[model samples]
Every structure is written in structure tokens, then in C-alpha cells.
Target: MQLLLPSDVVRKMRKHMFRAQRREIGGMIMGEQIADQQFRILDFSVDATSGTRSKFVRDAEQHDLVLKEFFERTGKEYHRFNYLGEWHTHPGFSVDPSLQDIYAMQDLVDGTGGVDFAVLLISRLRWFWQYDCSASLFLRDHQPVRVNIKREDPNAKTEGEL
Candidate 1:
């Protein structure tokens, strides 16, 4: 299946993705809801490889924990919230799943519902022929699905505190 993304959201994703690349850290986000899709991005998180986090970072290990917790927490946040997928950054102008990425995708599928989720990859910069920060989806059947990445502003206020 193909994913459709708004032009503006793609632009914003590129901006943050580059920031992560420069910091040598991985970026994460909640992919916006598609027009008629039944799923939504519950929350987003990032693990940077620069500054304090970079000193001793293990994204692969840490990501497992993060994903686990997120799944548990979001399951309670809303009855419909669930682990949709994952997004990471690639320090390049073109964002494509490398061999390692593909392996990771397979691992995620093996561990979870697989293609029922998505793994978004972003580039450090935009290229005329590359996807700066784009979303790719996978199916439990090991089919590759494309999702249109969208940009969304984080909520600046907290619940009941706003």
C-alpha cells in the first residue's frame, strides 16, 4: 500500500531529521493520521547520540525498552492507542532502509505484528530526488507499504495544566 503525506509535514520532518543527524542521534515522531487510516501516532520519542546521550548511547538496546514501555503506557492512555511502528534517522539526503534497517524491520515484525506497523526513515537534508524524512510501512505478511510522513507540532501544554 502507498502512504500519502502532506508537503508541509514532509518539510518539517526533514528539518528535525537533519537536527538529529547533526547531533549524531536518532529522532522519533508520531506520524500524523492519514485521511482514512484506522491508526494514529500515539506518541513520539527520540534518542540522540550527541551531547550527554551520545557519551554512552545504545539506541538498539534502549529502543527495545522504550518501545515496550510506550506500548504499555499508551495501551492505557486510550483504548485505541497501540504501538504503531518506529521511525529513525539516516544521516544522509536520501532515506532508505539499509541492510541493517531491513534487518531491524524484520526483527520488529518478528517480535510484533510486523507490517501492521511502520518504520520511518529520515534524511539529514532534502534532495531533489530523495526522501528527507519519509515513512515506510511494513505488513505482517512482509510486504513493504509506503506511508506519507506528516509534520505535527508538539503540545506545548500539559493536561489539566493548560
Candidate 2:
């Protein structure tokens, strides 16, 4: 699957990551599925002060609120726009998913929550506004697969331009 990260979302994530300094921060990723096996990340919750230097546990309640708000704003469309997955900052560490990250995503998809698959995006600020990131798709009874991520062009007038 391919994940499209909009420039605005990237900027918001970078701002939160920089403000968090060495600590990790994260939240839910909400977006729309534009085509087969393609998803666009439109917005994400910013968790600025709820993590340590090496660990981040998102506030489920806060993220739920964000999701609900998105749903309301989108006219409660379930298939067109919904929860995609999660994202978190790794700060000084590599962007690769830790063992814990893998297990968490696996549990999420495999659980009775009705999610057949989920994406985990791990990222860290490299320097200035530059970032190193990895996106992995977790499926039930399957290994995590590396997902291709394309950054959306801010000036693009249409999806074809991306």
C-alpha cells in the first residue's frame, strides 16, 4: 500500500517534534482512501507533552476526540474518511519501528476492533525541518511490510499532479 503525506501534515508533525525536543510524542492518523491501496494522510493529533525520551504512549481519549471531530466534519462518512493508523516521533533514535511498536500494531489489527490492517509511521527530525521516517503496514497473521510514502506537493492542483 502507498501512503501520501501532505506537506501541511508534515509541517505540523515537525513543529510538534521540535517542540518536544528529546521526548517522543505521537497520535492517531486520520485520512481518506483515495484509491485502491492508496491513502492520504490529511490530519494528525499532536501529543506534545505525554512521552519520555524513548517512549510514547498516545492518549487514547484525546485521539478518540480527534477522530470523532474528523468524522463529524466529514459528514460521518465511514468508508471515504476514517482512522488510518498511528504515528509517533522517535526523537534521537532511528525511524525504524521498535519491537514494542510492531507488537502494538499487530495487536491492534489482530484484535476484535475490526481493523484488518493498520499503518505505523515512525519518524524523527534529522536536522532543521528534514526528517527520516518509515511507514509499515501491519496485517493480521502476517509480518509487517514496508510501505511506500509519497510526500504531497503543496502546489499541486490535482491528484494526478502528485
Candidate 3:
């Protein structure tokens, strides 16, 4: 399975990553899940919070409301969009999943019944979070799935450019 993230959304994440700098900041990815093979991330939510340098906990309090707002702002075609999953930054480190990361993914999957799939997007950034962030994706308990931010982005090049 693969995920498609649009260019604007990628840019937004990069901006957030830069602002967070050495701290962890995260949000939810909102989009439609197409069949069992492809998913599209059309929008996101960045809840303002003072995250720590090592961990980020999404503000679930604002998650649903933010999603509803996005759903209304977009064309009717995106009304069916649901929670795709979460994304966080791992500043100056590999995007590999830590043991805690794995458990958090598992916990999310378990908390939501019928969620056959879930996403955990980890991005490793350079100094000052400049340049395109190194990204890794995990779908459910599966191995890391490569993220194709967008075909149009010149910096979409990565290990798995699917």
C-alpha cells in the first residue's frame, strides 16, 4: 500500500518542523483512504502546544473540530475524509520507529475499531529544519512505507518515491 501527500501539505509540515526546531510537534493527517492500496492526505491539523524535545502528543481536544472545519472548507468530494493517522518530527535523527513509536501506533489502532489501517509519519530534519525533511511512513503494523509527498515537488526524491 502507498500514501499520497500533496505538495502544499508537505510544505506546511516543513514549516511546522522548522518552527518546532529541537522540539517535537505533531498533528493529524486528514484524507480519504482509497481501497486497500492507496491513501491520500489532503489536509492536516497543527494544534498549538509546547511539545518537548523528545515527544509530541496531539491535542485530541481539537482534532475532531479541526477535521470538521477542513471538511466543510473543501469541496464536497472531500467530505468523506476521515482520520488517516498522525505525523511527528524527529529532529536531527533517523526516521526509524522507536519502541515507543511502535507502541503508540499499536495503541492508536487498537483504540479505534475497524481501523484496518493507520499511519505514523516520522520526518527527520536537518539543522534548523532546513531543506526537505527525510520522511518515513508506517501503515498499521506494516514496515515503513515510502511517502510520495507529491509528483510535482522537485524535492520528492527519496529512498521510496512511490
User: All candidates' TM-scores?
Assistant: 0.55, 0.93, 0.75
Q: Clashes in model 1: which pairs?
A: 3-146, 3-148, 9-151, 25-49, 49-54, 115-138, 115-139, 115-140, 123-132
Enumerate residue pairs that collide in model 2: none
Cα-based RMSD of candidate 2: 2.5
- Model 3 reaches what TM-score against the true structure? 0.75
**Per-residue error (Å), model 3, residue 132:** 5.6
lDDT of 1: 0.50
The window of 10 residues in a row where model 1 has the poorest summed lDDT is 153-162
Q: Write the per-residue lDDT of candidate 2 for residues 21-54, one digit (tens) a residue.
A: 8999999899999999999998888678889998
Q: Taking the tens digit of each residue's C-alpha lDDT, what string does model 3 give over 54-116?
A: 878877778778878877776545435776777787775667667787777766665553465
Each candidate's lDDT (Cα)?
0.50, 0.88, 0.67
In candidate 2, stretches whose alpha carbon ends up further than 4 angstroms from where it belongs are: 156-162
Model 1 lDDT per residue over 47-144, tens place:
65442311212355666676667657655453344455556555532466665566666666766534446565444454433344556766555766
Candidate 3's C-alpha runs over 4 A off are 34-36, 74-80, 112-114, 129-162
